[model samples]
Target: MPTDATPRPTIYDVAQRAGVSKSLVSLVLRDAPHVSEARRDAVLAAIDELGYRPSRAASALASQRTRTVGVLIDDFHNPWFVELLAGLRSVLDPAGYTASVADLALETASGRKPVDGFLAQHVDAIVIAADLAPGTLERVGVPIVVAGLRELGARDAGRAVDVVAGDDELGGRLATEHLLRLGHTRVAHLAGHSGPGDARRRGYESAMLAAGLEPITTGGGATTEAAGYSAACALLEAHPHVTGIVAANDVMAVGALAALRERGLSVPADVSVVGHDDSPLAAYRYLALTSVDGHSADVGAAAARALLRRLDSPDAPAHRELLALDLVVRGSTAPPPT
Candidate 1:
């Protein structure tokens, strides 16, 4: 009997199986913190078992506001966005706002405007954490918050844009100073093309000069692990005596690691390496990378706050916020071999 007996299960089925009301399940789905842990677990388990998927269409029709925000990320390959998204949802969920994320890298490949999809869905605002090409953000209409230091800026976009980012220059300075304090003077910086990359490079240079040491910077291209490896290879070949390196990000730092090993140098013993982002790769016991924590989550939360404020008062002065950063010393960096 191939009747409608196996009609797709709904939230009602989930609630009944979890032995709870539909409202409780809804609260859990919304990630409301007030839900008790035990009940939340039961609801989630039931959802998994029944394979119940929430209908965003139904959700939008019921809510007064579209309550959807668009988040534009630079690259899906970078893990830095993981923490940023977590911080974003922490505030967004409680406010009944849902996030719709898009990758700029993928969007560009399809030759579509980065925010076109969001506009079609009528998102309330957009968070930009990517470097958009010229005119890509022209007359976007929605409230826009530039979430990180990228090649793209509000002024360049020809629109008033709120900005919330980590002070990347400070992060670079902290990393260099940490290595300098550990008796390493010959330090090199692996460069990239992003806005934060330039700021970090400048910070490294200034720190080197302050100590009467010359700075060597290279690789003004992509910020991927492969680019880092290429830059490190060139740096080591040109200046084999270089004892310390500060890469643009953790992935790049991983690249530097391989370069060092190829040259038969031991981290912190023969050469020290410091990376930015403090990504999961940095924390791996095998890596234990000395890194700079830009407080990405805090930056994301601040950006969300800025977006909310702009939504409330579109004419208010565009907010500019730059959270401070700090260095996390680990086994990857230490005094140069004496």
Candidate 2:
């Protein structure tokens, strides 16, 4: 029946140990500026001695702010999110904000709404990095920022939301144009269903039309590797003479690689491949895929900055920013075999 009854240390205890007023201790915990180095050091040392942990819920209630941003990603499996997240943290961490991430794919698997989870946590704001269903953002009382060139849902629920994204349509055009410049005539695009994917597809089509060539498009909906492989296989079966490919993303390009190898074709020697996002996979020594660099990290940082702006001026008109993209040539692409 014995039970440990040691009471947990509180902020008052920290203030006593640090020999500072409760308000000064609070400022130190909040990391406010203008605090002297001596008092800050003493407060920190006292916190360590007492092993005191601040209560986020209590803090939020006191200040009416959580300073936490809920970031919803399309899929965690895609490495593209890695750079974007790093970019977001680069700005957010120094601003005394934290990011709480959730994956759309996982949320769907669990049959729960992704945005709902963020709201339940009482997050101060939400960053939409995934293409969510219509009305998903409806009735959500938090501020929002859409990242990575994705559109707000059909509901126009977030018409006032700020957006910071890469110029994906330009990225697609750059990838396709690279192959065209390499003397590739028969080019096929593996399209994806997302907002960015659709824009990239349009760029490819526009480039082909401008060159007086017909655009060959494949991939029904998803942007996954399996989808890419299947789309590539179908493209080869139908257009056996295709000499170049533009995949919607890097993973899809890798999928196309498998399909090409299975068909006994060599990359660059027989055909060339280009991908979007310029993810880590593209730089691998073995893959070395020619890819479109969307500067995902920059997009993330910009998005975080935009979110801060939205929080500061809730009444301000919505803003949209598009960062340009470029192509990185690598071993995966070359002039079509003569």
lDDT of 1 by residue, 192-301 (tens): 87988888998898899999999999886999999999999999999999999999899899999999999899997999999999888888999999999978899888
Best by lDDT: 2
Reference-based TM-score of each model: 0.80, 0.81
TM-score, candidate number 2 = 0.81
Error of 2 at 216 (Å): 0.3
Please, what are the lDDT tens digits per residue for candidate 2 over residues 1-338? Answer: 10125676889999999999989999999999999999999999999999877887445564477788999999998889889999999998999999999999999889977787887677888989998887788888878989976756423664588888999999989999999999999999999999899999999999999999999999958999999999999999999999999999999999999999999999989999999999999999999999999899999999999989989998788888999999999999999999
Error of 1 at 234 (Å): 0.3
Error of 2 at 256 (Å): 0.3
Worst 10 residues of 1 by lDDT: 1-10
Q: Rate the local accuracy (lDDT) of all candidates.
A: 0.88, 0.90
